[model samples]
Target: MTAHQLLGSDRHRDLRVRAERGAALGDAVMTSLVVPAEFRRVQDEYPILFRMNQERTDFVALALFGFENGENLFLKGDRWDARYRPLALAIQPFLIGHAAPDSDVRQVHVDTASPRISGDGEGIRVFDGDGRPTPYLEEVAELLGELDAGYRESAAFFAALRQHNLLEPFTLEIELDDGSINRLVGYHAIDEQKLAALGPDALGALHGEGHLMPIFMAVASLGRIAELVARKNQRNADG
Candidate 1:
């Protein structure tokens, strides 16, 4: 079970967070959920796709990191090889959440059980001795604020996609060098043919509403599938 606590100076003044990546610290993953606000940068680094949320009410935009679950091809040794790491990964061990109804501000919470947390200066400090936010904590607050705003924007973006009947599901099959096949089923990506078929009026609406860029970025990201394939092959060859 996860033991997440509301991060505060009073109770966690001794808190230290390590801003590093390691497979032993649960860094392995197939994908990270992304937001429309980051589509431009994220598309350049990973294949962008949409997965059905557990509730099936909204589609989650994802940056593909590996062909299968519990694996991340971008992670080599203790470092992430890609030039860009998704915001979702950068904000690990800390999450933005609400504390109660009628609360107007989002609060930051930490998973105390996370392997990254230490008391002996193993990581970033949450607060100084005077119970004040440190530079690192301030940056986290800003990032969390941006993430919250992005989520709100994404809700509207998904609504627009559904309104245009553009959401569709497809399967992807990956062949590894070791003669095993990895097939991803039930995931969805934007349909380019249908997108191109949109009427000028509809296209204009997407453009006017700032949705066209993300749509194109999502489609352009498909080109990165080959890059991921190469990484998987290299990993296999090295083994």
Candidate 2:
């Protein structure tokens, strides 16, 4: 179904409106959840250029979704950056994904876009000059298929978070290739003390065990409540 369709119902529209207005923490989480699906859609419909940003090598995935309106959506995530900024931009699609040399990295360019694929000392690169490429129709279609599958699996996890009302307040800290660090903070609430107790090694172990996301989601939910209470107290004092 189309995005508009997914967001067409009154309940979904209400959530969307609240999210657009920055009303609820859950809204932000839902927004993050929808972005990968949208990116998958773009990968299916248009030519996407993929390359590695070696300077910021921590990013696990990045994609630019160009629309007909001269706008683009930049979606990126890193294992270190706790914040999931989906729909992060409205620019051209310049997508990248971090893959180990042994990992499978895929790119797809549409026939209408001028597509070129090359390899550098670092990794494989794909470019679409006119934003159209006709030669790799089958390849592009397969890439989209894979992304769609990934989206579905990820969405299931996102949906669970939403159901638990634990979407915002978690943050991601990423260490890039340059040794600089970036943090992405979520709107969901969290307990700094509890998170600190977990420590980096415990957190890493949890992530390795596939429990990190859920745990982070729970922390973020609590953190959001803490923030709200603090803000309310500040407002009361001002009054």
Candidate 3:
């Protein structure tokens, strides 16, 4: 259902991408993949949690937006309520592509099938009349690069958490004003007790590896869980 092609000025000169937020453009979601690099900004708006991938071998960080599938509480009308969006979500419809399997070089690839692909002249242009990347494309490139680096750095970060037993299972129960209960399960969060009980040597090791700040940031982000509940309550009350 996706047609990923290497983005080229010659091939996609007139191609435009919609930058607005909406469910039709695939913005509807309960959680978004997040990287530690953006944890500071994400923590300020959304709770950061960890979930096992399909293979259940490694953990991936997520920025929680709602409690149910296809429900994004931060989505207010056509605009995202948060000031900062996770790079993973911001780099939608575009991804880093390699020229070859073994090649270190990266190229930008676009999903031609994405609803964000504009048919009319109603969105941001990828290339200018001079057949060069527009400022929007330039920004997309930067976001892609940062997301790529963050994904790579996350391997070591997750390994450190596993080695130190800093991740633990988490379950959340939310009660809306209408007294309906929502239970969220099958997620893991930073184990504050384990983190605090670590010996100085272990703590120093984590700090030296540059994994300490993000760990705390993930913990701090739990406060936003209450925010999500409030948003959910407001949505229900409005209805």
Best by TM-score: 3
Q: What's model 2's TM-score?
A: 0.25
Listed per candidate, the RMSD to the true structure in angstroms reads: 1.4, 18.3, 0.9
List lDDT for all candidates, in order. Answer: 0.88, 0.32, 0.94
What's the distance in Å from true for residue 134, model 3? 0.4
Each model's TM-score? 0.95, 0.25, 0.98
- Candidate 3 yields a Cα-based lDDT of 0.94
Instruction: Identify the runs in model 3 with alpha carbons over 4 angstroms from their true place.
Output: none
Ranking by lDDT: 3, 1, 2
lDDT of 3 by residue, 1-57 (tens): 899999999999999999999988999999999999889999999999999998989
Q: Scored by Cα lDDT, where does model 2 land?
A: 0.32
The total of clashing pairs for model 3 equals: 0
lDDT of 1: 0.88
Worst 10 residues of 3 by lDDT: 74-83
The alpha-carbon root-mean-square deviation between model 3 and the true structure, to one decimal in Å, is: 0.9
Which of the predicted structures, 1 or 2, would earn the higher TM-score when compared with the native? 1
Question: Cα lDDT for residue 88, model 3?
Answer: 85
Higher-ranked by lDDT: 1 or 3: 3
